[model samples]
Target: MEPVTTHSNHDEPAAASPIWPWVVIETLTSPDETTVVLDGASPRAFSRLNRTSVARASATAARMLGPLVAECASMSKPRDKYFPLRDDQLRRMMTIPVLGPSGHVHAVAVWVGGVEEPLPRTPIIGAIEWSVKGLAVANPAAQYLFRAPQGDLLTGHTIPEMLAAFDIWPDRPGFLSLFNLENLDVAADQWSGTATLHYDNPTDTHELFIAARAVGTGPNRVVRAVVTDITGTQNPGHADLTLVAVRAMPITPGHAVALADLKTGFIHEWLTSSPSSPLAAWRHHNPEFDDNSKLDVVQTCFALATGVRDTATHEVRVRFDPADDWIPLLAKWTLIGGGDRPQALIDVTPLAPISAPMVTGCRMCQDMANRNNAPHQ
Candidate 1:
């Protein structure tokens, strides 16, 4: 990608537009977290060899070169001036060298001033050449694990810790390094803007998808990692988007599901508590409403012959009969008076079946039969 140029004037406010164009060179560190910034003049002026060019160079030198001299005087700064090209200076950035499939140096990425950049080949030819020549005899152990073309290391957790959580480990020592991280399946390079990394552990499959241009950077060149869990199922009424409802339904015959419709405020309170119930789940899922408002409804389902109670206050009690196969499912809907809206929203459906007698003998039935000539109640 062509380096972006920003123009700024020295005489005007630092924020003002520039009269002369400048290219900001960023070097990224190995972890891709830290960065170093360098300011360069126009390509035309850098190509010229004159006193004015040298003076302009000196003024800019104080910003970057002073630190370099204090740190290491023997270091050779890049002669290109358009971009830094010194060997020792480049190595100090501590970027991992990326190799192509053919075992050739593909790119050198450095972390500088919190930005990651792949240096231009023309300026860093010497460093690339040197790294290639040494590759033939590089450490085999190091080569095996740190060979990933791209991707950052999983931070804040060690490989051992991850393995311990699953009670397993790779058979080889080199399998745990950052270089061995699987290449993100998504094409992030083509993205024109910031990228996001997504981790999915669906069915315990450790995989990642790189979504390009999913996030944007700030003025400081800080890249944010955006992660989404693709494996988890989202419940329509639950917060934390659970895959399975904490409440269970019986699979036996003659059993039915029952739901409760509670006020919205109480539902919100439940969801905020630890081990939130279905009502809490509903509130967690819908956060747009104020908790102080009356609850439109709270719904819950019960299996016939099961006893359930509110774990929080123990004030609500519900019981189901074994003979009841159909239970009501509850839903709450807001009603605005004198409006075209519905005054209430209620949906009751049979969730299961009942095995009890299908018919009953009633006095009304006998009276109807005798209505022609006999007495009726």
Candidate 2:
């Protein structure tokens, strides 16, 4: 049998501390069962148990090894993983494996601690291979890794359970599986897109955004990605109204002709259209534009910034007060590609109430709208 070795000497009284304690035990593995060959510890804990067999010391630990050893043996490196004994009060155990020449676990090093306390990281028996910053062995909600198409491993982490609570999972397991390597398609340099995913229940689905960066080429085929559950934040309680479309005109210094800008609110409001204040489309400096106009002071300030544009068309024309600080706007609407923000120039002609021909045509259009929406008998 190999002699047991540890960083701390068990013989010295000064060498022992409560926070950093050692309990080394030798394991005798047979084809049938595993038992304790020796119970090694310091003056406090294991020293008193030198006479107890593995079953006498803790039968619970002896049984827990079945699952723990199986899990530790599956890992690629020599490291200890924490497994909480939920059935036992606040009790946690670790499976630290000492590797042999064949790169297989030859013996198990165990650590018993409370919920807050972690296992000692220093090597007590075998190889010093586990990362100092390695994540706790608790079962995380999700684990992900990013690699180059050529298989260079990049950044990865155990997606914390907190995110799992919000339901962040990949849609259709696009490239997260890692074994098939087809899942690698979810990432690429400078990629931004949305996909749905599942969690605890495979049938229960949620959404996530995949953003990737190509990084570089060749041996350094670096790619980066951020998979996030946007279901929580998709509606920002407001929208960032960039000047999507504009009809800039001259002749009036402070007096404007048209207004185009962004508004903030839930995304549903951005995608939907209604006749009322349409899109909460607050336009600045207009009181009589529409009865649906924000009849309150809070919106008066909002319009001063987002432009008094109707949410439906995202365009407003100062047809009411032409002589005053007049601004008029027109927008082209498409039901299919509303999400596409395009930078194209289009011509516009303002409405005039006095033009009999234009007035008649407008009245006809209004009648057609009323007829389409009128309920049938």
> What is the C-alpha local distance difference test score of each model?
0.21, 0.30
Which stretches in model 2 have alpha-carbon errors above 4 Å?
1-33, 42-59, 74-88, 121-123, 126-377
- Name the best candidate (by lDDT): 2
- TM-scores for every candidate against the unseen true structure: 0.18, 0.21
Q: Write the per-residue lDDT of candidate 1 for residues 1-377, one digit (tens) a residue.
A: 11222223221121222122222222112222212121232111111111222224323322332233222212222211222222112111222333323243322322221123334332221111111001112222222222212232222222221222221122211111111111211212111111112223424332111111111222222111111122222211212111013123222222212222121111111111222112211211112222222122222211110123221111121112233232233232222111111112112222333112211232322333334335556
**lDDT, residue 377, model 1:** 68
Candidate 2 residues 181-221, lDDT tens each?
12112222232344444544667554444432232343333
Runs of candidate 1 exceeding 4 Å displacement? 1-88, 91-204, 207-225, 228-248, 251-377
Q: Least accurate stretch of 10 residues (summed lDDT) in model 1?
A: 125-134
Candidate maximizing TM-score:
2
